[model samples]
Target: MANTTTTTPNAAQDTLVLIGRALIAYLFIPAGIGKLMGFAGTVGYINSVGLPLPEVGAAIAILVELVLGIALLVGFKTRWTAIAMAIFTVAAALFFHKYWSAPDAMKMMQQINFNKNIAIAGGLLALSAFGPGRFSIDKK
Candidate 1:
């Protein structure tokens, strides 16, 4: 073949971003299902944490994650869904994982999980502003 080169500054970023969104959506699906099914133990934990309207909050969170995860998976209204999810994730990290001055193991675990969520939320924030790549319903 003749010499050929095809690359763009945004191409890799777009591909990685799409993959990241897909993975996040995939993980959320099961978690959402757990919440949707009223996993009694989980709801109990939420209540124990003193979340206001704990049951209702759990339900809403389930629906938001499930529905928005689906939407994000298909890249439909990608930006909006990403932004909404970003907000939810950040809130969850703050509310549930804000362990300070705890045992080192627990604190480290919480910090890792919390930071992971925040990083994902950051990706979502970028997605919300950038819109999905050419491979999305937002494009169609």
Candidate 2:
């Protein structure tokens, strides 16, 4: 005897995944565009953080947040994109949101930002593991 089980498309789950992708994309796409438009300001901020090669950093940020961010939104190469975004988010939190080293007045704000980045990274990791769902170009 043979046993069989049927699998059905989950429209709700797929829609939720698309919405999650959109929300994540919203955070990076505008941020990337802002950095691109204010190239000097972005470089200056990177320099202020005492990171070398601020220009290179800014360019890489633009590429990751803008280009790869759009890819994430469209669910193209989503697993790799999500993984890259997750890693970048964690690195950025560690480098830029060093709340432990922040002044007393700024510590709370920095900590909040750091935690937020970590949470975002968690979401991205989940996306990477589960994939972009049926609504994505990847599924097509």
Candidate 3:
């Protein structure tokens, strides 16, 4: 018989989970860091949206994005972090993106952002269901 090597499904899944974690974290972490560094800008933008307590909202956003993004990146508390991020993404899409009411000139951009958030939320939900995989802090 000829010798052959085959990769296990679990190994493939583990690599995919790691890649997913890194990609999502890449999307969130820089934005979080930028928000933290430009606190005044984030606060001003939040206030412009007419949401109450812009400072509080900005702080909450910074914490959730940075902390949860890091947790997802390192595969720590995977399911819980993913769930939290998913909820956060949905809320942000509704409250901030609101493409349905945008003016015609900006409507398409806002709609794109809103849809992107929803897509990201779906990915997060999937990550929560599948978890961080074997090469993670939550590994068995």
Candidate 4:
């Protein structure tokens, strides 16, 4: 006589956490590389937005995307990294992606950036509150 049981909640949650990490990693890798290689004209674009410290902001953004992307991918300090990223995301959306009252063409681009930032920010917010689960460095 044998009995079968479903996976525990922790196991399911662990899998979900891994998926979330993967999602963030995939999204950020290109961004990190772009910043690292000065591709996509992101640095110049940041400055054009009238940011107070374009170089410093660009450097910080690169570091966050690289370091935090790696941390999230490996599930290390998941909550903390996620929280920092979430705040960063919101700040970026608010500052550069301001859609309201923007010109038609600019509005389209701002809308796109704004939407994507909000979505990614939501995921990071979830990670901040829910944690990375047992399949992470923080767990060990």
Clash counts per candidate, in order, are: 0, 0, 0, 0
Ordered by TM-score, highest first, the candidates read: 2, 3, 4, 1
Residue pairs whose backbone atoms clash in candidate 3: none
Q: What value does the lDDT take at residue 110 in candidate 3?
A: 98
CA lDDT of every candidate? 0.82, 0.96, 0.92, 0.86
lDDT tens string, model 4, 1-140? Answer: 66786455578778988987988888887788888798447668887888877778888888788889999988888888998998888898998889996898799889999999999999998988878888889889
Clashing pairs in 1: none
Cα displacement (Å) at residue 75, model 2: 0.4
lDDT, candidate 2, 51-85, per-residue tens? 99999999999998999899999999999999999
In candidate 1 the C-alpha lDDT for residue 90 amounts to: 92
lDDT of 1: 0.82
Best by TM-score: 2
Error of 3 at 15 (Å): 0.3
lDDT of 2: 0.96
Global fold similarity of model 2 (TM-score): 0.93
Off by over 4 Å in 1: 1-15, 101-105
How would you encode candidate 3's per-residue C-alpha lDDT over 1-140 as one tens digit per residue?
97698655588899999999999999899989999999999999999999999999988898778988999999999999999999999999999998899999989999999999999999999999878988778885
lDDT ranking, high to low: 2, 3, 4, 1
